[model samples]
Target chain A: MSRKKGFWRSSVWSLSLLAVLAGCGSNAASDSNGAAGGTATNAAGSDSEKEPVVLKLTTWNPISQTVVDKFQEKYPYITIEHDKVYDQFREIIRTRIVSKSDMDMLWLFPNQVAEFSKEDVLMDITGSPWLDNYLEAAVKLGTVDGKTYGVPYNSQPIVMFYNKTLFGELGLEIPQTWDELLAVSEQIKGSGTAPMVIGSKDGWATQFITTAQFGLYQHDNPDVFAQVASGEKKWTDPEFSTYFDGMKELADKGYLLENSVGLSYDQVAQVFKEGKAAMWPMGEWGYSENFDADFSAFELGAFPIPVNRGDQPLVTSLVSDNLLVGVSWSKHQEEIKLFMEFVADPEIAKIWSDETKQAVTVKGGTSETYSPLASSLQPLVDASEAQIFPSMTSSIEPVMFPIFQQILLKQDVDTSKLLEQLQAAQNKDI
Target chain B: MKFMNFRNYIMFILPALLIYLLFFAGPIFSGLYYGFTDWNGFSFKADWVGLENFREAFRDPLLLTALKNMLILSVVVIVLQHSFSILLAVLLDQKLKGIVWMRAVIFFPVILNTVVIGYVWSYMYAPMVGFLPKFFDAIGLHGLAALDWLGDPSLAIYAIALVMVWQYTGYSMMIYLAGLQSVSGEIYEAASIDGAGPWNKFWRVTLPLLIPSVIVNTVLSVIGCMKMFEHVFIMTQGGPANSTQTFGIMIYQYAFKTSQMGYGTAMAMILSVMILAVTYVQIKLLSRMEVAN
Candidate 1:
């Protein structure tokens, strides 16, 4: 019995020691890999050419397989492993960074550039030659503190997708001003059809409405967001509150889809596709081939959300999407740069634009085969200005979504109080 | 022999203890450490902010709203789940045809993945095209049909709580069933001989004896509901104006979404303390009740 007990005790202790050693061994291995990566970054060009490299690209956005195949064909030594993480993308990326995972490239949003760069997770690509090929506004989206960290991929403006068949049936021409929009909405509502679909349940969807208003607001006061950030202006001021009030008016007048707060973004698209509503306020991706909805049931037409300015051509609010950034810790810096140059190529950008149906940020990258629905928005896109909403660039962006949701959900919501909440969130962030 | 047995016992538990210390205890202690700092998650520079995060958390209207919602959900889940579970346990405990199959049917939802259940309930509660609204419309109850189950700010949390009860009541029922099975049949016979009616016997004998099960069920339900995330996250994402937001969702939003890891950790520590304190008081009171009964 003593011998048996001794054996058991020895075995258990040995197993525990093994577990500890295994953990330490893995850590040591990780440390060595990190050291190697750091060295390789300094000695990249020559070392990268001879040694075959596999780059790990992580993105929440869908990348075209054809684009990947073309890139691989051009650079045979470089193998790209694309990992798509849709749900909890930011959280997962943060975890990967903390774990020192070998993520070579990342598809990020423009809003995330400052935050990620501040964390020192992004590689500075300010001096990259291919950056000159992008539009000035596109390049500016990924630049923080006068240093570029990401390559802007697409310029997707939030536009209104109206059922052309329904619009024709209702005798509603595209509204050019806010008042005109309200009048058209009222007419559509009077005909027993919901005027618009806003998926307030998915809180982020509410940004489309709010950002459109901000887009118009920024046209006149370009430094409005900067003033708000610096405490020169308050969110509760009429300058900001009026836009929210505009949003509330649409809800108050029963113009938006009933029970829209119950619908997801995809569900609202489905609602629009089913002809349940006259207009769907969403990003340009809604009409793209990548969109889940089948719009064959109705003639789809899109227009920029009408600003208050009547005669002046509408300045569409263009938001940069799929901003590709190199992970700072990646071993294959040369390979990542090569991929960046490939994406920046106008021909490759055109292929990407054609496949994804987004307006690529590369100069001369717009696809010629745009459908009439996509083609209609070209004038607005040409006159578009990228406006950074103060809330989106700040830490208060998450809270802004809920505030927008509250405005849409509650008919009698106090816009001043909601804006006060925004001010408070901003103060806390500061 | 006693010394040898003690050594052997320590050895047996050594591996598990090492793992527990390494993973669970280590992370918790590290989390507590981080709670005192202003760590923005990705940055290695974490300046110590003392109790600032916790102090701000108290003033945070969103955190207060989340706490209120969590408490309401906990109470609703506990009451509804326990009542349904006790009733079902009693009903199914009786010797009847297909009682085993009936128990299995009741327990089926408990076995289903929470994500699957959340999605299923979401579809069922979805507006305009959902089963509940369509069913109500078909039955000539247009008013109920028009009611947005998961949308209306006043109704969303309760709607989620209903799903919680539906999924977890069976789990609680099994516990009560086990307690029922353990109760000797002779005790009921004695009660009957003493001229006790069904309700009298249940009140004086069955329920009091089932105190252990009640304690177990209540504690589990309270903790489970306090940590409610997957259901609310999957269904409404604490949306339609932050109505269904709980501590769990708020913690996640702060930690990951807003990049306030230190503040999120502080919130988490507060939640853990709250859970521990609540559970402690509950066990104390319930254990006293058990002893008295």
Candidate 2:
């Protein structure tokens, strides 16, 4: 009887041990699967090519289902699982990347591309044939250390969208220089309308005026930020402080919308739509079909934010938007490549541009259909000597938002001190 | 026989023990280890930098601002939330018409998700188009209507604290109500017979009996407010010049946004210690009061 009881006890212990081992084994397998570039079922010896693959593409920006459908229709073997993360996108993406999650592709911001490239979380797509179709400058945005990690899908130029009806009523013409812009703003303020509406409460919106000015600055000092990084120049120098001076002048003179610091981006958009402000400084993407439907009551016109004091030609900031990058750990590299190539096609780019109302980066990808405002902005987009604004780069971008917010919010803000702070932040990062 | 029982007990609890060690204890230990290293979120390698992150955190002005904001939020929430909950509990404990519905109505917000509450309050606190502003405008208080509740740095944290109080007062009230109900009728009757007025009876009898509930509520509120993230994140995103940034949001910004996971983890470890110390003192003081009662 004792021997039989001991045998039963040993059997129970063996089964429990096996159970625990199985649990641990499964976890290890799943973890290794991500690092080893294999799917869960691939461990079972199935041919990966014959198996239908679902590639997970995560983005924070809006994407069209039509584009996804078209991509899927062309490649029947691959399915794109579009995951949209609305809030805390960068944080989520960072966590996902760190964990070696099964993310096939991602839409990265320029700074994110720069930061992620340093960690080798993104695939180097240098010398890809499809990249030849994009504008060289746009393609250069995703390149760091002479290797491309992302492909720019759209070019967003920060332009001033003026209330045409309001300008007409006030007999104001498009400002061609900084002095003329200030005069127009003063006149608009005199006419009992807010000169400009900026959603400074959302820190990112504070970049519009500064970025526009920096574009003109960069036109002269193309290597200004690089110099700052190398300790040859300071952010407090007139080259950078001049931009803040212009932005501060607008705030100090009461030319901005009342309580502009309190208004959110969406609220400011609505205020501009209601003709409460004379000009709304935003990216060209703001002139979408939804904006058209809501803002149909009044006509709108676009102009580059004039940043020159004299006869210096106008230049506006062009930022690369909707950058598609391949995850380094993705098992479906070929499928991700195919998808990227498909997007690089001019026809596909045109469809995306039309759907998003943003300019595509692909050569010959200009949409045939354009709104009147977009049409008016196209010449500026085409002819303006635009560059990625200095503050938009990865090293200096983080401090820009808070410093710009301080400029807008604090009446007696020490511009020199704020610039010093920016320099200090850049120094720390370096 | 005892050894056999012991073996059976170990066999039964081994699975649970392994799970707890793996999931709960494992992360905490790893986090503690990471706190001493310089682990950017992207890189797998973490170099040891003993006491450096903590030293830097002390000098970080933004961390100081976040700490200040967190303390102010905690004090405001603890005082106001407890006072209002105790008041509501006392009132609802009285014999009143439709009291059940009133209790349910009051408790409804407690059941709602924090994110839902945050978004709803964001709409309510929005400047022009929000319900509060419109209501104030309708009541002819245009000045109040024009106040930017979430955007103004001075007012944003307080506004979020108010939302926290609104969502959680009902939960605290429920606990107080339970404490109130557990008290025998004879105690109140005896106080009444001793010629004690309503105020005296509440102070001497009801309030003393509610000491346990107050302790529970205070500890929970302190911990919850210390870790406040959702409302501030969803509403202002610590904006308008980092006015509403809390310690939790600061950690998140460093850990994920800036890729300084080690520094963020160090700050989190400091916050955890602070919370533990504060909670310990609170419980000790409250428990003494309970013992006195």
- For residue A248, what is the lDDT in candidate 1? 80
Predicted structure with the largest lDDT when compared to the true one? 1
- Which ranges in model 1 have alpha carbons more than 4 Å from their true place? A1-49, A221-238, A289-294, A310-313, A370-372, A383-391, B1-10
Q: What DockQ do the predictions score, one after another?
A: 0.58, 0.48
lDDT per model, in order? 0.81, 0.80
- Give the Cα-based TM-score of candidate 1 against the true structure: 0.92
- For every candidate in turn, the CA RMSD to the true structure comes to 3.3, 3.7
lDDT of 2 by residue, B1-293 (tens): 78778767776776677667777898899999999998887786999999999999999888877878888888998889988999999999989999999999999999999899988897788777778888999999999999888877788888999999999989999999999999999998999999999999889999999998899998999898888888888887787788888888888877876677899999999999989999999999999999988
Model 1: DockQ vs. true structure: 0.58
Clashes of 2: 0
lDDT of 1 by residue, A325-404 (tens): 98776767777888899989888888888777677789998686644456677875565555533235446767788878
TM-score of each: 0.92, 0.92
Off-target runs (Cα >4 Å) in candidate 2 are A1-51, A226-233, A289-294, A370-372, A389-398
